[model samples]
Target: MKVWILIFVCMFSMPLLVAVLHFRMRKGQTLKIRQDYVKNARYFGRSFSALVEKALPEMKNGMIMLSRQEKVLETDGKQEFVQPEIEDLIIARNTIFCPQQEDLHFQKEIYSEKDALFVKENIRLRAVYSKKRLLFGNKIRLLRWADAEHAVAVYDECDLGERVSSGEQLVIGFENVFHSLYAPVIRLGQRPEEPDRFMEERDPRIFRMPVMNSYEYNRHYIDDDMVTEGGTVPYTIISRGDIKVIEDIILQGDIHSDGAVRIMENASVLGNIFAENDILLEKNATVLGNIFTQGNIIFEEGASAGQPDKIISVVARGTITFYGGNNIYGYVVSEGGGKILKSDREISGEYCFPGEPVHEEKITFRDLSEYENVDFQGFRGDIYVKEAIIPEGASVIPKSQFFECRSLEKVYLPESVSVIEDYAFADCHVLKVWESIEKLSLKSVGISAFENCYALEFVSLPDSLTVIGGAAFAECVSVNKLIFSDTSLLKKIGDHAFRGCRNLKEVYLPDSVEYVGVSAFRDCSSLEQISVSEKIKNQPGIAELEKNCPNARIRFREVNSVEKE
Candidate 1:
């Protein structure tokens, strides 16, 4: 019994003694750690204060200025500027600081080598790519260089999940909420995958409201202004600020919009657009200017001013069709099929004119083969001849022949022919008349008599001509020189008839007439000089004479009679 009592007492006392010693040792370590921490904190504060002074000068203006000394002390040994930190922040040009810490707000901040805040943050980064502006929002903790998959997420900061895989696409912001940052897009490339589905998935609030940038957005805009994968589009999303674009834009340069692009009455776009699909412009939604497309073009019924002389060319794969009334000025060509349905209107040909009489002759296949020519013995009626002759006759006379002959080369007018009808000899090619009609009492020449004659170079009209037709000598590409002894008929030049006559170098028209056709002397590329009578100076066509013919020099000669000079 005495031995058992002794053993128990020893065990109990041993336990108490061990507990007291352990408590004392723990207290000593805690006190030592506290003292050391206090001592280091003072040193850190002093070093940071000195370094803050060193970095102040390099900070850019307008950025929120921080208390440099205080911020440095809080960072403790991590303050890189004063050389007190264990790790140093590397600041590079055109780079942003993406802090990994959760407590930090800005993932990317402008990197400045001299700013104390950047120095304390231990920012380590490199320049990825830069442009005019950059924006960010949401709880995006891990910031890395943008890849094809992460592009949309980086821009919108919304969870795209599997919908946005890669390639190019237009991303709509969340509800009336958009990423707060605005950047200019220079170049964009997009490969469409289910274009309609993507647009349909866009949030309505984002589509309805005006957008802008936020502080949570990158405070600093991009430098250098480059666009690697986005473009400036004619988007109808609501936004308050001016939408500025720096690059030549393309939605592929082609976009497929799911809904209507409605621009409010006050909104405007100062750029051009091209669409891959049909464009639906709702009523009251005004497009200020031109819109182009790669596919079919459709306009909803309403008063809409598209573009002035803007629909220069419209190409269709199947059939290009217009629904409502459209005013088209330029030439319209259809490769597949061109079908025109004219509404209530009368279309008639010009039948009555005071010129050559080519249509009145009783031309028979037998007459064309017999004389190698038909003699118009001054019969005052219009006549048409193709690859035939006008023989000199006392009773019967052939009038103006081959007025609008699309294909007929040579014509032989008889010497007895006195009154040549209007445009009788117009548009004739390879016409070689061997001076058969001598001293003929020719009175009038038709409009566009030799228009577009690529082969005829020189020909002589009768000296007794009084009325010269409008556009009589237009587009005679091969005819280079012409002479007229009658100075009085100079002012009666035809309209645009001489246009594109690349070989026509000299022309002489008399001053007897007063009215000239518009575009008469246009595009005479080879024309060296023109002699115009002073009497026709104030004529209507003369005002625009020099504007059209740049190669020709006009000689306002004092004229009673003149030849090609």
Candidate 2:
């Protein structure tokens, strides 16, 4: 029993001895760690102090001083300058630290890597890194600042040639070798310019405006015709009634008439002319700007519009006719028809005469099976057939050939067809199905070829197609899917090509497609998936499509790889 009691006492004392030894070792480790931390902190403080001392001299010298005179000393000459902290420099430059009253017409100009102009009331100027031109409209002060060795200069002024009538002060600032300085001030007032004789001498019957002036008049007739010789009109002239310019007239501003406008021989107009009724330009007439009319427009012999390189459009709701020796440098658009009578006339721009669509009750194509080839160059008959078949070996479909066939439900395209021109099947609201004759040899589908076909649900593009022109399938709201042929050679899809296709759910764009124009697939609200190559997916055209259909899932694949949906 004594041996057992000794053993118990030893066991309890052993635990107490072990606890004292553990506490002593832990205290020694804590003391060493504290000493190491203190040594490292002292070294870091010395290194940071050395860095601040090295940067302080540069910071002090970089401070910009705005002075009234051009020559200024860097230091105060007698005493040594004390360098301010980086935070102090930033606060001094920031408007928040030194608030100033807002200047009403403050204009600021700063020279960036690119030339940039800014106009603001109270703002800090930042350095520019690229070369670009920027214009701002307001009055502001220009601020130039320097940091380290980099220097920036800013100047504020109105655009040099801008006409300002109000008395405004212009301030110019720049950075010199030693200091930032402002140049001598210049105050400008509105100049007194004389009005044109025609504008000064107003007539009740004729609308007359000088350059930089505008006027309106009632029904006017220029019987003398020579009254507009050497006349200058910088602003618009509007008339409520018919206008007749007899002969040898010259005017600068645009002319708008509610009734018919007639310009006699040797008349020249520098600006656009519009008429609610017909417009007639007689022999030797020259127009520099566009001509638009609701009624017919006629250009007689020796008439010219626009320069050779510039485009001046001529548009008319009715027919447009051009006589001999006419040189038109712009486009001509007519809703009804267009006729060019003279061979000597030169038209540099396109002439579009989308002839009236056939509006007849019914159309039949019973003889289509017998014909090996069909040509519809100027056919004006209705194409609203209940059923139509283009037999094999049929070659071409001319522009506007089958436009506005509202009742057409089915169409069969022949394998041998090579060309389908613009607006071939436009406005075919009921056309729901298309059957091709085995293989298609078609090369091009022109602008607005199948636009507004509301009943079309799906389309399988042919392999031989190379071009799809602008707005080819626009407003095809019911088209749910578009399948590209495995061997498609398509290269271009023009602007607004698939716009307003609300029900389009899936589309497969082949790697052969190189260009997808602006606004393509815009407003495709029901689009769920699109498959495209990586190169095509990153293009701006795809970005535009994504913007319009935010819910569409885009699957990008490498060229010649299996497509993912």
Give lDDT per model, in order.
Answer: 0.36, 0.53
What are the clashing pairs of model 2?
105-139, 106-139, 106-140, 107-139, 107-140, 113-130, 114-130, 114-131, 114-132, 211-234
Where is model 1 more than 4 Å wrong at Cα?
1-386, 394-407, 423-427, 433-439, 486-491, 511-513, 559-565
Quote the positional error of residue 284 for candidate 2 in Å: 40
Candidate with maximal lDDT: 2
**Candidate 2 wrong stretches, greater than 4 Å:** 1-384, 561-565
Residue 447 in candidate 2, Cα distance off native in Å: 0.4
lDDT, candidate 1, 1-565, per-residue tens: 9999999999989989999898877732111112113222113223433444356465453222334322211222132243322122233333332333323322222323211112122222221121111222332222223112112222212221211111121222221111111111100111111122211322222111221211111111111242233322323222222222222221111112322232222222322223433343322222323444434433222212222212123332222232222222112222332222222322123211111111212333334323322222111112223354555552222244454443455555555555555555554554544354335666655665655556665634456666556656666676777667653333355555565677778877665655666666667777787777777766656656677677778888675564432
Task: For model 2, state the Cα shift of residue 33 in Å.
Answer: 80
Taking the tens digit of each residue's C-alpha lDDT, what string does model 2 give over 292-350?
Answer: 99998887865656532233477789876656445454345577655444242232233
lDDT score, candidate 1, position 247: 21
Q: What is candidate 1's local distance difference test score? A: 0.36
TM values, all candidates: 0.30, 0.35
